[model samples]
Target: MRPAAAGTTRLLCLAGVVTAVGLLPWLSGRNPALTVLRARSAEQEPTREALDAVRRDLGLGAGPLHLLGDWAGGLLRGDLGTSWVSHTEVGPSVAAGLQVSLGLMGAALAVALLPAAALVAPVLVRGRGSAGAGAAMLAAVPEFLLATVALLVCGVWLGWLPTSGWQGPEHLVLPAVALGVPAGGLLGRLVADALPAVLDERWVELWRGAGVSRARVAWAALRRVVPPLVPQFGMAAVGLTGGAVAVETVFAVPGIGRTALGAAKSQDLPLLQGSVLALLLLGLVAGVAAAFTRRALLGPALRDASLTLPTARPVRTHPAIPLTLFTLLAVTIGWGLLRDPYAVHTTARLAAPSWAHPLGTDGLGRDVLARLGHGAASTVGTATAVCLLSLLVALALGFLPGVAAGAADIANALPPVIVGILVAAAAGPGTGGAALAVALISWPPLAAHAAALVQEVRSSGFLTAQRALGAPRSWILTRHVLPSVAAPVARHALLRLPGIALALASLGFLGLGAQPPAPEWGLLLDESRAYVERAPWAALAPAVALALLAGLAVSGAAYAQGRAAYDQGRRTVASAVRKEAPVGI
Candidate 1:
């Protein structure tokens, strides 16, 4: 297809996806007014007539198709529908939210780039070791935790910045820093990846040999890096749409994220649907535009990743450790689901660990074991769901021909915290929200990985054989490409477990995970913080769970990297063995 035609088709597809996304409230039985009125009806044993009246009054009778038609019809007339909360035209609110969100994203990106550039510069000289590792670690920290710590240390302790609300420049500082720190860390790695190639250029060597200052060399290297970096950042910028929810909410930024969040909470269907659709389109367009802009600036060089940089070494981690962690996670989840956390044990109130009360009790005289058990189910379950869901989405994208790279770029750039928050806002606080959020944000990296694997496999000798033999593309792909890529994708998923775990925890910690009484570890931490002095185990129990989850995640990532190195060496030796084998055995 022609480029413009293809672009138009893709836009149409994305519009359809957006419309489908807007219909989720119906798909999941999450209609806000329906949920609320249902609860009231249950309390009063409401009549069928009264229930129907309530549904009609709250505008809950419309199906997803009808809602979409209404939304599109309103758009044709330049109306953004109306807000249920204030009964005002949503265009004004959406516009205001857009301004805030855009400003926040811009500031956050600006703050992130400076630090990332600094971090990347050192790696160009040092090679990939300390600088790269440190940056990667920092990037792994969830934005919600980053924001919380910043608030505690900077706002409460130091009185440096406002903890909440978009009042002025000062208000934006903390949120930007919270969001930017991880982004900068991510960008730094990309810069590190891109830098070595620039430094390897003949011109760079000649400049250095001619005694051109290190500053000049660095500047030249940076200029080369920027083109590749711009496209990557474009993807990241779009990913920020879902991920910005926590940043906006934590800081009360009054941005589109926060507005949409409220709309989701209240089940203000028209407002929520319109606002989310607009923001999503905006992010997607900006990212695609920025990436293409680089193509315009640097031509084919910026477009072809292989020409710009080498394949990234696959990250490795301890395969056995993740299994162990997964087992423990499973146990906790199973136990939690079977037990009641809120059942008070009057005699064992605030009791220390014993045969009956293994983990100990809390300040409220509740059984600590029950609560911990409950939390384990939610926390681990949420993490597992996030991990698997992300992989599935990635797999789907990778199955597509050319879309994987762009999709992956955007996904990688997104913060899981932002995604978790957005999902929580739309789906409400539960497994569905956290899992969907993590899954959405996690797709980019996996998609990118899958795309690369597909590209590599497409050129393999076996595939060439199949093609030459006139085997169908589907048969070749099913029998060849899928098998070759499966192991690596599985390993990548293991490598990503820690990130998924952290995101789940971060969301729960911010009261955006499983709601009250659901034993979510992050929620436990939040709930037990007040009782830390009285019953340390209540807090310590959840803290330890989180730490273990994090450790397991880290181990998996590190192990994946080590395994990649090991496998590469083994392949080299095997290749040598085959080369030296007698003809036809």
Candidate 2:
């Protein structure tokens, strides 16, 4: 057999084995009733005998092989058995939750994408630096923070929208906007960056020189750019799935997130596992769709590009800004460490800021300031790690075939709560466990982005030219393609960091994150719920910290995108000028 075929077979076997191993515990945790029902009548003697007979009759009594066969058959038929926690049919409950989640997600995408497209159009047309900066600022804000602010302003203060519950369209607006804003900002930057390249293409210039109107050129450029965005749009849709948990919880929506959160807290293994599996399946479907769409849009060119290396862009050294930003970030970190956030000691009814208890105490007698500080650190750290890990996994998987890449995307598209549940079940709940869970959930989008970047870079003239040269494939890929794609990929990765962090913190807040005594921000919020009326600051402090951390991480990503655009702009102008030179004698 060919080496490639052998590799493919090996990978398939590995995937099957890993999946089976991962699901073993969940299967073992199913209801005893279902296990007994599938057994032989002859073994039914006394109650204990009947139980043993049932186990034997079904594959469970026979051996590992029988159990595996039964499990595989059940999985193939989508008979996930009953949810151990909810005591309902796993499939139906998941289906119901999925409907609500998808509805909210669809609305969010509409709100986010349309406005982003409109906002980015002018930037793409003018190639303005300010436009990029604006996009960055918008993208930098975290969704949960945005949701909280929206709740206060639109729901509480103005009463323009409902603060909680999925009553109707009005309730969705606040949460959807909160979710869409960050996504819109990121998408705006992407569209803006992509447009300039298409606008400055040789064909565009050639058409322009032939007396085509600026409008025509712009329209044509947009047409070309639109097709490449299908995969991106699908990827965005998938990523949004992970955010649904926070959005649903914040809005008090009756969705899968709330269900999963409740299940996790109760240690309802079957319900949690079923929810996770459903989420994974949803993400996989989206990813597969995206992969097919990418292929359809790019045609045979993408396959050719995949096999080739990318080329390097000229790197311009920018001085001092990175250092200055780093310094500012450090100061913020220091401030978080030193400052007291919570006010009013509900536990003691003591006055604020005495020498004995500088930051006072919470209703539970916990050190408010210390908890807040630690919570901030933990929240930021966990989120950042999850986002980074997810990105790395996604990038690794993205280089595979379209089908495999799509599978990664599908995994990314699964709901964050579901992912959280799976991770918690698979690894158990803790810092390490949460991070791993986040990574597993976040991998699909990162993979999609990496794949898209690879496609974009592969088609560039520099890469093609490099290939035509006598350069070895490995040397060219390392020296050229990797460098060219690194900055943009890094920017994409950074942009995702805040969102993941917010989601993790939200999960924690809902009591699905770090177990007690971990000092996580989410746990702090949950702890503060009883005393919210007496000491709102107890909850408010951690909430605000979560928002700010998300904002800063997002800002960093936006800044990176802006710098990348500026650099790309300069290269395009230089290339245009070179092409316009007169012929030598």
Q: Which predicted model would earn the best TM-score?
A: 1
Give one digit per residue, the lDDT tens place, for model 2 in 308-391.
111212222233544554565455556546754443345565225456544446675666666666666777777777766766
Off by over 4 Å in 1: 1-9, 21-31, 34-59, 62-65, 124-130, 157-160, 296-307, 312-374, 385-399, 403-429, 436-444, 463-480, 506-513, 525-555, 573-585
How much lDDT does each candidate structure score? 0.69, 0.62
TM-score of each: 0.77, 0.69
What's the alpha carbon RMSD for model 1?
Answer: 5.3
Residue 252 error for model 2, in Å?
2.5
Q: Weakest 10 consecutive residues, lDDT, candidate 1?
A: 126-135
